[model samples]
Target: MGNRLSKIYTRTGDDGTTGLGDGSRVGKDSARVSAYGTVDEANSCIGLVLASELPDDVRALLVAVQHQLFDLGGELCIPGHAAIFEADIERLEAQLDAFNEPLPPLKDFILPGGGEAAARCHIARTVVRRAERETVNLARHDAVRPEAVRYLNRLSDLLFVLARVLARASGHGEVLWNHERRKA
Candidate 1:
């Protein structure tokens, strides 16, 4: 862990190939790269959400999530590696339960829009779902921990709950979708 990234541009990937943590090189467009890139996108989306003013506890949880996402990315970079652990998934599940406990039962579909931070969280949730899908696809061809996919699935749930929490915290109630009502 001593300056593993001393140089940002290694030029090694200039030829459309990138190095893995296992010292192997693969095409930049490989499934592994795609999976990791999606995870990275989810991470960045969380960062954008974090940029908004949030409660201290929520901020702390999101910060931890960012680190876990990095671990998930590392696991993707090195195929067959289990960088993301069960504890990470458990943490998300705990947060999900905590955040969703107070919300009224969802009897109807909810729109993704809410407060700015909540909207961003929903966007991140969609990215997490995409990442999970890519990870599952990559697993079809290579050895991937089932936990990684499980973690992403749970994370997307957590993000949804967090978005709802944020909207409530910001005094913006959930945007319930009126399925039967036509837009004027």
Candidate 2:
């Protein structure tokens, strides 16, 4: 872990190809690269949400999620690598349930605006959803661990719940969609 990237400006990718964890070079726009890049984007969005003031428990959970996302990215970077597992997916499901338990059930569609932190969380949730879709597309043409896909799926769900929790924590509650507003 010491200076793993001491020389960050490597000219290896000047040919429009990037190196993978296994030392193989692939096009920058390859499916694998796109999948992992989306995962990285999701992690950054989560970081933005973490920058906002949040409850301690929520903060801790998001920190853990960041690490897991990095692992998931690593798993995608290296072919045949297994970083995400059933336990990771299960943990996300448990967190989702715990966070969702105290909130009233949804009666209408959510509009993704509750508070500053909650809005950021919603953004993160959508990015995670994109990551899931990209990973699924990659799986169509290559080998991918089932757990990796499952982890992204559960993580998106957890992010949705977290957004709701953050919204309530910020005293903004949820902004429900008005299906019939246009008729008014």
Candidate 3:
């Protein structure tokens, strides 16, 4: 880490290409970059939710998730390098089960609002979905591991459930979709 960032502006990417962990440069719009970039965006959204009120266990889980996302991004940074472990995906699944156990079963689709924290969670959920799509696209064109895509898929589902949890914490329940209401 001694020489990690001696200079903030390298000026090397003046041509719009960035170096990968493997020391090879590619276009900033490359699939690999897009995959990890969206993951970073989702991570930021999750950070916003973390700044709001959340249960202790939920907070801890999101913190762990942030680390896992970093690992995932790192994996995408280097070709043929793997940073995500099977245990990471398994842990996400376990947390999903624990968080969803108490929520009432959904009978219809729902909107994505219920106060600030819950709304932030909903935003995070959409970003996670976009990250998943980007990862899947990267996998289709690159030699990426299947588990990376799997992790993003599971994370999206977890975010959805966590949004519901946040709504409950705010005593708003879920704002279920009202199809029978007046047309917009």
Candidate 4:
């Protein structure tokens, strides 16, 4: 990792191909690249959520998640690299439970809107789901750690809970879906 990114533009991807962490080149549209690229997109979405006002604990959790996502991206970039582990998934589950414990039980479906920050968290949650799908697709073609997939699965759940927490923290509360609302 020494001086690897000293120069920003390498002009090497002009051919629609990119290099992996193992010095191997593949098409930019390849499954592996798409998988890791989606993970990066999810990370950026989380960063957007972080840019707004948030609870202290939520802020810390998201910051750590950003780093974990970087590791997940690395795991996808390197064919045999093992960045995600069992403990990481366990941590996410524990955090999810802690944040969700005080929340009221959901009897009605909830919409994405809760407030600006909460809405953004919902968007991040969707992107993480997409990343999980992409990673699962990549697994169909190559070796992928089960923990990686499990991590993404658990992360999306954590984000969903966090969105609810943020909504409450911002005093917007949950926006329940109105199934009986008249539609034009």
Among all candidates shown, the one with the greatest TM-score: 2
What TM-score quantifies how close candidate 1 is to the native fold? Answer: 0.94
User: What's the best-to-worst order under TM-score?
Assistant: 2, 4, 3, 1
For candidate 4, lDDT tens digit of each residue in 1-184? 5887789999999999999999999999999999999999999999999999999999999999999999999999999999999999999999999999999999999999899999999999999999999999999999999999999999999999999999998999989999888875
Q: Taking the tens digit of each residue's C-alpha lDDT, what string does model 2 give over 1-184?
A: 6869888899989999999999999999999999999999999999999899999999999999999999999999999999988988888899899999998988898989999999999999999999999999999999999998999989988888889888988999999998898995
Please estimate how well model 4 matches the true structure, expressed as its whole-model Cα lDDT.
Answer: 0.96
Highest lDDT, which number?
A: 4
Estimate, for each residue in 50-134, the C-alpha lDDT of model 1 and write its tens digit: 9998999999999999999999999999866778888878878988898889888879877897889899999999999999999
* Tens-digit per-residue lDDT, 1-184, candidate 3: 4798778999999999999989999999999999999999999999999999999988999988998898889899899989887888898899999899988898999799987889999999999899989988998998889889889989989999999999889988788899988976
Q: What is the overall TM-score of model 2 with all chains considered together?
A: 0.98
Residue 42 error, candidate 1, Å: 0.6
Model 2 regions lying over 4 Å from their true place: none
Report the Cα RMSD per candidate: 1.5, 0.8, 1.4, 1.3
